[model samples]
Target: MRIGLDIGGTKIDAVAVAPTGQTVDRVRVPTGFGAEQVVANTLQVIDALRGRTGTTPTAVGIGIPGLIDHETGWVRHAVNLGLSEVALGPLVAEHVGLPVQVENDVNVAALGAAQAMHLDGAHAYLNIGTGLAAGIVVDRRLWRGARGNAGEVGHIPVLADGPPCVCGQRGCLETVASGSALAAAWPGHPGTTATEVFDSADAGDPAATAVRDRFVAGVASAVRILVVTVDVDSVVIGGGLAALGERLLLPLRADFDEAARSSPFVASLGLSSRVLLAPLDQPLAALGAAHLAPESAVTTA
Candidate 1:
């Protein structure tokens, strides 16, 4: 068995995967802030999973947000977790006595999403959560570019003069399309802003409709960018807002269809047909983390 952990801003989801790619056991624990606390919590989850499964895992894999040196398993600029620069992999491995590998959260999610969706060939997992970004997977393996920024599509400037982004840029696709963007456009319901925006738009609220339309347009633009850039086999939409399901998918597809009618190039790409929703039922990040473990370390029956 191999252990995989998805360390998020809120919690750490841990799982043990059998050699056959089945999850044998799973556990969740609150995530901690800062390097020390985060490391401690991660170890705690590993211990918890071991106790639950009553078996020693061969290797450990971690998926976390922020910039990471995949080769070194070093994490940097993880502001949300209060980690500036930490050798997360080496520390975890020293403590647990198991080989460990770390990767960007979105990359791991792309790996997991591909496995869950049974996608072969090139695909992109477009994460539309608090921000917008994508993870590219080609032939079931992550394609992290030379600098590990292959899928930072969110920072692409779409509007010449638009709202500023946290990345110190103006008119970024993220500023117009992400969960944060939806919350900023339709505030007051901190927890349910996306739902509120879509629901109100459905009721014909002009203001809400405008927000929804702009958000959908930004998303459609992202889809187009991914399809044209990598020409991936498909783009799977996932993240918190994806819970909106067809409410989000329908409009996004309509936008694509409408654009296709005007642009033959767009029609030939079949952007609408290539778009898909990630499976909501599985823990993609954790599963993908498991897959990150070296094949040699996976134990067979």
Candidate 2:
């Protein structure tokens, strides 16, 4: 068996995958802050999976949010996790005595989405979370690009003087299209801000409708950029807002359809038809991490 863990800021979603790609066991634990605590919780989750499965895993994979050196499993500037720089892969491997692979969270999610959706050719996994970004997958393999910035689409400035982004940019796609953007536009929601905005819009609130429409337009722009630049076979939307399901997807598609009406270029691309949502039922990040295990260690049925 191979173990995979999706270590998020709030929780760690872990799984044990058999060679045939079946999940043997899964576990979840609250993530700890700081490097030490994060590493400790990761080990604890691995132990829990092993105890439940009653078998030792040959290799382990971790999908985490950060700037990662995938070759060495080194993590840098994982602000949410309170990690500055750490040899996460080595530390975990030393304790568990297994070869470990660490990769960016979105990248792993892309891999999982490809496998789950049975997608072939090229595709992009667009994550619309607190920030916006994408993961590129071609023929089931990740394309990190030369500097590992292949899918950093969120930072691409759209409006010349819109809002200041955390990346020190003005009017980035993320500034207008992400969870943080929704929170800024529709604050004071105890629950999900995106849900609240959509609900208020559905009730015909002009302010809320404006916010929703702008956010949807920004998302549609992101999809257009991905398709036009990479020409991916499809763009799968995932992340916290995706929980809104068809409520979110229908508007995005509608935006594309509206644009298609004006521009033959947009119509030719079939932008509306090429967009999709990631499977809500699966822990895509953890599943994708499993695929990062050494090929020789993976067993197929």
lDDT of every model, 2 decimals: 0.90, 0.90
Name the regions of candidate 1 deviating beyond 4 angstroms.
Answer: 293-301
Q: What is the lDDT of residue 221 in candidate 2?
A: 93
Clashing pairs in 1: none
Quote the lDDT for 113 in model 1.
95
Q: Quote the RMSD, in angstroms, for model 2.
A: 3.1
The runs of at least 3 residues in candidate 2 whose Cα sits more than 4 Å from the true structure, single-residue gaps closed, are 293-301
Q: Estimate each model's TM-score.
A: 0.95, 0.95
Q: After aligning candidate 1 to the native by TM-score, how far in Å is the CA of 76 from where it should be?
A: 1.2
